[model samples]
Target chain A: MTHQRWFTPWLLVAPAAVWLAVFSLWPSLNTVVLAFTNAKPLGGGRFTGVENFARITDDAQLGDALLNSVIYMVVCVPLLTLLPLLLAVLVQRKLPGISFFRTAFYTPVIASAVVVALIWGWVLEERGLVNGLAQQLGVLSGPLPFLTDRWLLLLSAISLTVWKGLGYYMIIYLSALGNVSRELHEAAFVDGAGPVRRFFNVTVPGVRNTMALVSVLISVSALRVFSELYVLSDGTGGPGGQDMSVVMLIQMYSRGFTGHLGYASALSLLLFAVTIGPMLLLLRLNRKAA
Target chain B: MRKGWLIPVAAAAAVLLLSGCGLGGDGGAGEDVDASGEVKGKVTFQTWALQPKFTDYVQGVIDAFEAAYPGTEVEWLDQPGDGYSDKVLSQAAGGSLPDVVNLPPDFVLPLVQQGMLLDIEGADDKLNADYVTGGIDAYRYTGHNGVYAYPWYLNTDVNYWNTELLAKYGLDPAKLPTTVDELIAQARTMKKESGGEVYLMSRKPELGDLANAGVPIMAEDGKSFVFNTPEAAAVLDKYRAAFAEGLMPRDVLTDKYAGNAELFNSGTVAWTTGGGNYITSLATDNPTLAPKVIPSPAMGTPPLYAQGLSVASGSKNLPTAMALARWVTNAENQAAFAHLVNIFPSTKASANDPFFAQSDGTPSGDAKVIAFTSLAQARMLQPVEVTGAMSDIVKQQISLAISGDASSQEALDAAVEQCDKLIGQ
Candidate 1:
């Protein structure tokens, strides 16, 4: 009876295990194998050891893409993680018409990236809202090159990423906030701790695991962001492709025009490794905190 | 949740994912049929922008083809102009290529390299009877030894300038520069006289700058880069200076295919390069600015191309596909197709016809005459002899130079080195 009971648990997990193996694990393994080959767009390719890696090193735009990706992650991760926590705490209170504000904040999460880009593209154009405001205030004479300048374009992309991610992470934090014990806050109140201090000591510590989850999620999204950048800048990546993300460069290589499937696969593996490195660091930090 | 309770959710998740199977593959290669034997089976014909507007005309052509070739069925498909090149190549690789499909000029070399196109030499004599030579040359990406597509329609280069903007600064539109230096001088004068309020250009005249300056972009072999000299550097420097001077739009380096159209129509740019049809679009956007527009001769080798039709080499119904391709591009059909879309036809007979050559007194007519005149010198920018992979590297390097991030000499040297590596590879 005991042996049968143990066997049933394995049988129960077998389906999910097979599902992951076929859909996720196999494709990732295939991609890693392809990084070492002269793969065409389709299936077959010839093995060419380390040639793709050499090409990656020699690629002129690789450095720019990596730097852009790093800048993106740095600007976005903290913004998504903290801003949403603040917003979630604010909206979690029992207030009249609070759901409306919650819905409004969450609207962008459901909107497509292309749609968000189009709306923001208009708002940031020369004659658009920001410039109009500047012109009205007489603080600036000419329109700001919001979408034109390279640094400004990167700023715009990072801002867009933060805005799009705010509501998503807010929902995550809201669920975690529900699990935060009210007794801790009551006990802190009895101890004479102020709202800010109690929040730092109680709410933040209570949601430490959720913070780590949000960090990983936002980091991956920031690293893989392409569509918004592409739609906002029309895919040129701002002048000498200074604002181009690593994934966007990989996309260009994978497109039928460039036909660098092997190189793109190598880029994919590199991106995977890059994504995992930060994730591992986040996990380590999470463990230390625990 | 309990272990037994979680089983339902996991099973459901696994089932949902496993059910999402990918079912995609081609029907198979077509069987051989006698040239004169009764033509049968279906051929899927496609185009980029020839539907809804030309529904009747296209249907008539299909009906005629079907009637002429008994038992043969023509299935027409229309794809959007955006991203058609990528979609076509991916489809070719997926083995689900349309029997006869439109070929974008940029996709021609890539598709040929992938061996997805049919060698249309089987009926070359009939197909080439009175076709435009440049159009035919554009489709022959594999060189004179092979023909991959049937030339269909052209979009000749014509630069439309804002005469109102020019005349406001006491500049004469009739005295437009024919050479690169003169153009740069004109740009400087426009920027200076206008006090930097109005820009002179929005796009970098790549082909024009090189073609007019008499600098060869690539050697005759197309494999070697011969543009690393001072002449190339001068052209790059001139454009870089223009950009630095704020003569061009800020998006000059990154404007996509719909380059600077919105900026020009908004009365910002003084010059915009496009085909004759843009006159209508510009006029539609700004009614008052329509009469102020001046159509000028193309300055460089207008690297416009005739979108053509190609039968996939892996097509099962080659005979039917070839017949449909020929029928679609025959002189009479091409002229009719041109009338529907306001595009330049690629057949000698159609282009030579008075409908395209003769000018009416309207602004649109003047634009057409300039476009037709420029067609005589239009060159396909995709150099046939050069590999597509190498060309991309060259173009990206040129963009870097234009952005002023890389010096002109550095860009050229880098292009040369990369091209050599690509050749060696």
Candidate 2:
């Protein structure tokens, strides 16, 4: 009898449910469907199953993109996850004006990515401040080509990504750090454990769940690193296509020369598979860990 | 419990009712009840004019268009100084394209091939004959059924020199390089004479500034890449030598479009190939050390070139768009735009517009007359099918070659192979 009345609660939620179904869920499903076909934004294409996947496999540019994506994930994910934790712990200390330090670190998040890239581009230019400073300090006889050279290009882009993301993830860890029982650190010290060991055993495990959550978040972000590369290299990626990633390839596929909507859809589907499948697997692992 | 359920159920019903009412209200509000099938609508117009130097004139013209056409609104959209093309293409793919847009003249063929444009009324017909003969041709693509854009304006590349820099280097103030070889020699001379303080010449090695030159770097025949020829390599070799001689920075290969401009304005670069408006900008921004504009040194023969504008084919109101296009190219409007912009006008009649006559405070003299005659000879890049992919492939490979990562032969071979693949597709 009580269950009969609960039907009204379900009915009341129906409109929001319908809204999400139409806008979010349906579009995502359509993207997957279109990815399997040669359909364009204007529509009209026949289905082609694993052909897109096979084509992505054979494409040299796509291969390069996949490699770059993996590289970004491998380098950026752990650094992004760990650096923020370290930064949060350092800032959370009762050092004077810790609040001001937190605000200063978070400020980059408020600035737009394009602006950040532009500022960094200037700082990294051949005669830019970094090179000028290095030369003045007798560090090098010549300036380093930050945007042009492959090694430096990737280094500069990754550094910018880590810098921009630090404060945001710092705040996340900061919140988690707040809930850590202070008594645990005291007990560890009473047992005569050093500060470093106490931090590793007590502080780290105290926020293990938050660290896991942020790791997954950073992994997903690493999968979609486009704007920083695009901004640094003026849309073409770095010279010789050294820093080009999958998202840039997807963009080029969609609207570049031929605007092969079908090809782009195929690439999109492949990208979705690459990004989401692993993310879900990781989430499942996280659940198991929990 | 039953009463509580009623509250949620009533809320859901209210939401459904409110949405239905909203939809109905929207449909009623914008209904065109007038007998005339007039679409009083707005269309976005995107352009790359951003600097305080150029944006005002562009915005002024757009404003004039909207003012002239009472019902049709023209929204001006400006791209930022960097990553302008990337943003433009992204906006196009997202299908939030401005109804009207301007791409660099050389990019017209690629844009058409991508199906980003809509067919217009005046592409191939006798209507195109009314503008400069070759102007409409550049905006046409074979893959596109009809003309996709209308010819907007023409500008010619000229050599700009700081007479102060030239005089200080012990070079003649009035004389300029007359041939490719002569330009190289002068570049070397300027470098040595200036104690390596100034770059005698500054331009991107990819020859982007030269893409508009009247002669094709590679001919229309797809079989061979002409830019990889001995003559073009000779040009690149000169740049390589200049770079080696410390006339230009070794990292010149990495400099973006504005790097040379900055070098020129800052007085570190003595002479360079620059846009037509450089002299005007110099006079306006840096009056004391205003650079003198002169004809480009001959490369076999003096060739002329300029950027072109076109109307998009996918426009919803074709006639209105055509009207706007025609109006912009008309003698009166071209003259207005010319006065406002100080670039050469598309129309012959508008070339003599008082704007150019009074500009530089120079009277209708031989130099002005010669500049106009050169405009007549000015040619844009020919419209080629498969240009979009072909050019990108060329750019990619050439960038590699310029960076010393690949040989010229390897780059051209890769480009040709890529071009073949694209053409086959």
Residue-level lDDT of model 2, residues A29-107, one tens digit each, is 5566556555433323446666666666666667767877887888988898899999999999898898999999999
> DockQ for each of the predicted structures, in order?
0.29, 0.18
What clash pairs does model 2 have? Answer: B117-B314, B118-B313, B118-B314, B119-B313, B149-B311, B150-B311, B178-B298
Question: Where does candidate 1 chain B have its weakest 10-residue lDDT segment?
Answer: B20-29
Model 1 Cα shift for residue B412 (angstroms) = 3.2
Q: Write the per-residue lDDT of candidate 1 for residues A43-82, one digit (tens) a residue.
A: 3355668888888888777788888888888988888889
Positional deviation of residue A62's Cα in model 1 after best superposition, in angstroms: 1.3
Q: Please give me the DockQ of candidate 1 compared with the native complex.
A: 0.29
Each candidate's fnat, listed in order, reads 0.30, 0.15
Residue-level error in angstroms, candidate 1, position B239: 1.1
| Candidate whose lDDT is highest | 1
Which lDDT tens digits does candidate 2 get at residues B1-425? Answer: 54676688667655553332222221111111111234346666776664566666666666777777788877677777576666765665555666667666545554554555655432334445456655555555543445555566666555566667777887886677766556668777887887766777665455342343332454455433455554445445555555556666544544444457667777778766545556656666666656344434223322345444455545566445555555656666666665554456655566455545443543112234445555655554333443444555566666666666776556655665555543432
TM-scores computed on chain B for all candidates: 0.84, 0.70
Which pairs of residues collide in candidate 1? B30-B316, B208-B300
